[model samples]
Target: MAMLPVYILAGICLSYIILLLSLLYGWRNLKNNPRFVSPFETGFSIIIPFRNEQLHLPGLFDSLKNLKYPKNKFEILLINDSSEDDSEKLVQEFRKMHADLSIELLQNQRESISAKKDAIKVGIDKSRFEYIVTTDADCKVPENWLQGFDNYIESQDSDLIAAPVIFVEVHPEDPLFRKFDLIDFMSLQATTIGSFGLRKPFICNAANLCFKKKAFQVVGGYKQSGNYAGGDDVFLLQKFKEHKRKIDFVRSNNMIVTTSAQKDLRSFIQQRLRWAAKSAGYDDSFARFAALTVFLMNAALIIGLVLCLFDASYLQWLMIAFLIKFNLDFMLIYKAAVFFDRKASMRSYALSSIAYPLFSSGISLTSLFVGFKWKGRGYRK
Candidate 1:
C-alpha cells in the first residue's frame, strides 16, 4: 500500500511528460509551417455578440473603423443579447458615424438557454457574406484581421479557421491578479495551438473563430448545443470536426485578437467556472481526456501536499512532483508567451504555479455542483 502513492506520482509524471512532448511537437510543427497571405477576395460577415458591454464597445468600434479590409467586402452584424445598458445606443451612435460601412444592429432571438448561441445564430441568418466570423464585443482585432483571414481562406479550402486571442496588458503597473490571469490564459492558448498540432483539435475561442455559412447550416447552427450558456465556440468547432471538415488554426500575428482580463478575483473565478462548466458536455474524447488529465495532475499535486503533513518523508516526493510539473508547464507556456509577445508575464509564473493547483482543483470541483454568474446572468449546470 505504501507504494501506491509512489505509483500514482509516477503515472502523473509520465502523463505530464507526454503532454509536454505533445505541446512541444505542436509548437514546432506550427513554427515550421508558415501561412502566407494572398489577395483578399472572400467576403466576411463579422458577428459581434454583446450584453452590457458599454465600457468596451468603444475599443471594438475603434478597431472596426481601423480595419484595413475593403469596406464593401465585409459587413458587421452587432447582435444585442438583451443588455440593460446603453450598448444599443452606443452601437447606433457608432453606426451613424460610419455610414459607409455595412453595419447592422439586431436583437437576439432567444430560442434556448444560451442567449449567446442564439445571438450568433441570428447574426448568421442575417449575414449576407459567404464566411461568418465571430468575435466578442470586449475584444479588439488587428487592423489586418479580416485581410489575414481572407488571405487564408482564399489560399486554402478550409471550412473553419481558429485564430489566436490574448489578454491586453492594461498597464506596466498591473496587479498580481491580472498577471495570474495572463499566465493562465496563455497556458490555455498554448494548449489550443498544441492540440491542433497533435491533429486532435479540441479547443478554440469564439472571440476569434471563423467558419463557413454553409458549414454552420449543415451542423444545424447550435440547435442542440444551445442548452449550455458557454461553449458557443468550442461546441461549434466540435461539430465541424465531427463532420471531418477542414479546420485550420490561423497562427499569424496579424490575426490575433486581444481582450481585457477579468479585473477582480471573484469575476475571474466566475469566468473560469463558466468555462469549466462546459467540460461535462464535451463530445470530443480527446478534449475530455486532456481536461481530465490536467485536472487530475493538479489534484495530485494538492493531494501530495496534504500527504506531506502526515509524514515529513513525503516532502521529498512532493518536491519532485512540483518540479516536474513546473518545468514542463513553463516550457509549453514559454513557447506560447514568445509567440504572443508577452514573455514579461513569466515574472509571476513561480508564484502563480504554487497557487494554480489549488485554484484549478477548486474550480473543477465547484463547477460540478454550484452555478456561476456571467454577463449579469446566473446559470446552473
Candidate 2:
C-alpha cells in the first residue's frame, strides 16, 4: 500500500514517455521533398479573420505583396469581425495601392458563437477558388507559402493540408519570456507533425491551413462547432476526419508562416485559456487521450513534488519520473527546433521545463471553470 503512489507515478510517466516516443517516430517519418512542378495551377482563396489587429496588418500586407505565386491564381479575403480599430481602413488602402492583386475586404456575418469560424465560412462562400487557405492577420507568410501548397496539392490528392507556424526568430538577447513562448510553440508544432506522421492528426493551426472548399462544404463546415468561441481549425479537422477526407501536413520549412508571440504574460495566459476552452468540444478519441495524458503527466509531476516534501521516499520516484519526461520532451522539441530553424530557442529549455508543469497544469484547470477573453470578447466553458 505504501508503494501505491510509486506505481501510479511510474504508470503516468510511462504513458507520457510512450506518447512522446510514438510522436518522435512520426515526426521523423514525415517528409516533404518539394517536387519541381511547372507553371503553378492550383487557385487559392486566402482567408484572414481580424479584430483590432491594425498593428499587425502591415506585416501581413508586406508578406502578401512578396508572394511568389501568380496573383491571378489567388485572391486575398480579409474578414473583419467588428474591428473597432483602423484594421478595415488599412485593408482598403492596401487594396487600392495594389489593384493588380486580388484583395477583398468584407465584414464578418456573425451567424455563430465562434466569430473566427463564421468569418472563415463567409470568406469561403465568397471565394472564387477551389482551395481555401486560412491564416491570422498577425501572421507573415513566406514568399513560397502559396507555392508550397500549390506544389503539394499538385502532388497529392489531399483534401486538407496543415503547414507550420513559428514565431519570428528569437535572439538570445531577447527576453526569456519570448524564448519560453517560442519553445512552447515549437513543442506544439512538433506534436502536430508527429501526429501527422502517425496518420492520425488531431491538431492544426488555422494560421497555416489549406483545404478544399468543397470538402469543407461536404463536412458541413463549422456549424456543429459553432457554440464554441474558438477551434475554427480543430473542429473542422475533426469533421473532415469523420468523413474520411484525405488530410496531410506540409513538411517543408520554406513554407512556414511566422507570427509574433504574445507581448505580455497576461495576454499569453489568455491565449492559452482560449485554446484550452475548445478542448471540451474535441470528439477525437486520440485528441482526448493525448490531452488527458499530457495534463495528467504535468499534474502528477506537481503532485509528486509535493508528496516528496511530506515523505522522503517519494523523492526517488519523482526524480525518475521527471528525468523520463525531461529527456523525452527535449528530444521531441529538439527535432522540431531543427525543422523550424529556431534551435537557438532551445537554450531556455531547462528553465522552461521546470516551469511548464505549473503553467500547463494551471491553464488546463483554469480553462475548465474560468472564462477567458480573446480578440476583445469574453468566453466561458
Candidate 3:
C-alpha cells in the first residue's frame, strides 16, 4: 500500500502522455500542402466587436486598408459594445477615409449575458453577404485574410472554418513573462489544430473564425449557450458539431490573425480566469475530458513536488516523471513555435515549464470559486 501514491502519479502522468501522443499524431496528420490557388469567389461579411478598444482600433483599420481582396467582395461591420472611449470616433474616421470600401458602424443591442455575442448577432442580422467572418477589434488581419477564406470556402463544403491567431512577435530583450504568454497561447493554437485534425474539433477562437449565416441561424445563433459571457466561439463550435455542420481549420500561415498578450500578471490571471469560467458551458465531452486531464496532471505534479520536500526519496522518481511530461510538452509546443515562426521564444520554455503547473492549478481553482473581470465587468461561472 505504500506504493499507492506512486501508482496514482504514474496513472495521471501516463494518461497525459497518451493524450499528448494522440495530439502529436493529429498534428502531424494536419498539413498545409501548397496547391493550385482558387479564385476569390466567396463574399465575406467581416464582423468586429469592440468595447473600449481605442488604442487597438488604428492597427485594425490599417490592416483592413492593406487587404488585397476586392473591395466589392467584402463588407466590414464594426459593432460598438458601449465603448466609453474614442473607439467610435476611430471607426467613423476610418469609414470617412475609406468611403470606397463597404464599412458600417452599428451599436450592440445587449439581449444576452454575452455582449460580444449580441454584437455579433446584430452584425449578422445586418450583414449583406452569405459568409460571416469574425475577428476581435484588437487583432490585425493579414493581407490575404479574406482571400484565404475564399479559397478554402470554394474548395471545401464546410459550414465553419477556424483559422489561427498568434501574439505579436516578442523581442529577445522583452520580459520573460511575455515569452511565457506567447508559448502558452501557441500551445492553445496547437491543440486547436490537432483537435481538428483528429476530427474532434472542440475549441475555436472568435478572433479568426468564419461561418455561414445560415449555419448560425440553424444553430439558433448562440441561443443555446447565450448565458455565458466568454464562450462566444467555443459554444458556437459545439453547436455546429451537435447539428452535424461541417467544420474545418485553415492550415495556412497567411491566414493568421495577430493580437496582443496581456501586459501584466494581474491582467493575465484575470484573462485566464475569464476563459476558464466559460468551460462550464461546454457540452463537448472531448473538450471537458481534455480540460480535466490537463488540470489533474498539473495538480498532481504540484502535489508530487510538495511531497518531495517532505521526503527525499520521492525526488528521483518525481524528476523522472517531470522529465517525461516536459519532453512531451516541448515536442508539441516546439512544433507550434516553428509553425508560427517564433522558435526564438522557445528559449524561455524551460523556465515557463517549471512555473506552469502552479499557474494552471491556481487559475483553475480560482475560476471555480472566484469571479473574474473582463472589459470592465465581472463574471462568474
Candidate 4:
C-alpha cells in the first residue's frame, strides 16, 4: 500500500516534466516566429477540391470575393470530387454571377480510394498557372490570402510554402468535449509552423498548404502516400524534406486560413484515427519524433489513470498527477492560442488536458484494428 502511492506519484511527476519540456520547446518556437505584415504578390492558381460542400461555399465565396490580390493574378479552380450533390452547378452558378472572378469548375476524375487526393491530382491537371495554392472548400481565407502567398514566393526561393490553419468556433454554446478537440488541433498548428521557424520540423496542414506546380511533379505528390487514407500534407512534406529542398512556413496572420471545428465527438475521433494510422508509414524522423512525443505523453497519462482505479494509496498521487498534467499542457496550448489568435479557447484547456491523452491513444489503437471509412470508401493501413 505504501509503495503504491509512491509509484503513482512518481509516474505522474515524470509525465509532467516531459510535458513541461515539450511546452518550453513550443514556447521557444512561438517567440522565434514573430508575424510579418507584407502582402503576397505571386500569380497563383488557387485549387480547391469539394464534395458535398454546398453548405460551406457561401462563406468561401465571400472570402474569394473579399481577397485583396489583383483579381486577374489569381484564378479559382474548384474540382467537384464526384459529389451527388449540386456542388458543380453551384460553382458554375457562382461563376456566372461573378463573371470577372476568373473561377473555373472542373470535374474530379476518381483514380483512388481517397477522393481528396484524386481531386487534387485532377486539379493539378486543370491548372494553367505555375504556382498552386490549395485550400479546403470549408475554409474561410483572409482577404490577403493570395497576396501573402505571392509576396512570400517572390521574396523567397523555396519551392514549397506551408501556411497557418486555425479553427473558428461557430457555435458559442458548443460542449466542452467539442472545444476540447479544438484545443488539441490548435497546439498542432502552432507546433507545425514553429517547427519551420525552429528548423528540423515536420508538420503541415493541407487546408492551407501551397507549393509550386513543379514541386508536386518533382516529389510525385500523392503517389507516395496513395495507399494510405490521408496525409496529403505530411507525405508531400517528407518529399520536400528529402530533397533538402527549401519549404517555408508562412507565419503571418494574413496567411492564416480559418476552418471549422468538428461538430461532434464521433466524427472527431474517426478523423483523428484516420490521421494516426498514417504515422506508421511516416519516413521523416522529425515527424516521427513529434508523433512519439505525443504518444509518450498520452501513455504516461493512461498509466496514471489505470493506477488510480484500485490503488487507494493513489488518493494523494491522483491530485499531483492531474495538476502536473494540466499545468504542462497549459503552457503549450497557451502559446499556441496566442500565436493563432484564439486565446479564448484556452478556457477549454482543462478538459482537453484530461481527454487528450486517452483520445490520442484510442485513435492510435482504433487505427490498428479497423480500416476507416471516408467519403464512401474504405482504406487499409
Candidate lDDT scores, in order, read 0.89, 0.91, 0.90, 0.76
lDDT of 3 by residue, 1-381 (tens): 257778888988888987889889889989883543768788999999999999999999999999998899999999999999999999999999999999999999989888989999999999999999999999999998988888888888779999999999999888777888999998999899889989988888999999999988988878988778888899899999999998999988898899988868778788889888888777787888889889988898888898888887887778877898789999999999999899999999999999999999998998889988889888766
User: What CA RMSD would candidate 2 show?
Assistant: 1.2
Q: Which scores higher on lDDT, 1 or 4?
A: 1
The ten-residue window of minimal lDDT in model 4 covers 30-39
Model 1 lDDT per residue over 37-100, tens place = 5677899999999999999999999999999888999999999999999999999999999999
True lDDT of residue 263, candidate 3: 69
TM-score of candidate 3 against the unseen true structure: 0.98
Query: What's the C-alpha lDDT at position 323 in model 3?
Result: 94
lDDT of 3: 0.90
Tens digit of lDDT per residue, candidate 2, span 1-381? Answer: 289989888888888988999999998889765643535889999999999999999999999999988988999999999999999999999999999999999989989788888899889999999999999999999988888888888888789999999988888788787888899999999999999999989999999999999999999998899999989899999999999999999888787899988988888889999999999998998888889999999999999998888898888888888888899999999998998888888889999999999999999999999989898788877
Q: Rank the candidates by lDDT, best first.
A: 2, 3, 1, 4
Q: lDDT of candidate 4 vs native?
A: 0.76
Highest-scoring model, lDDT: 2
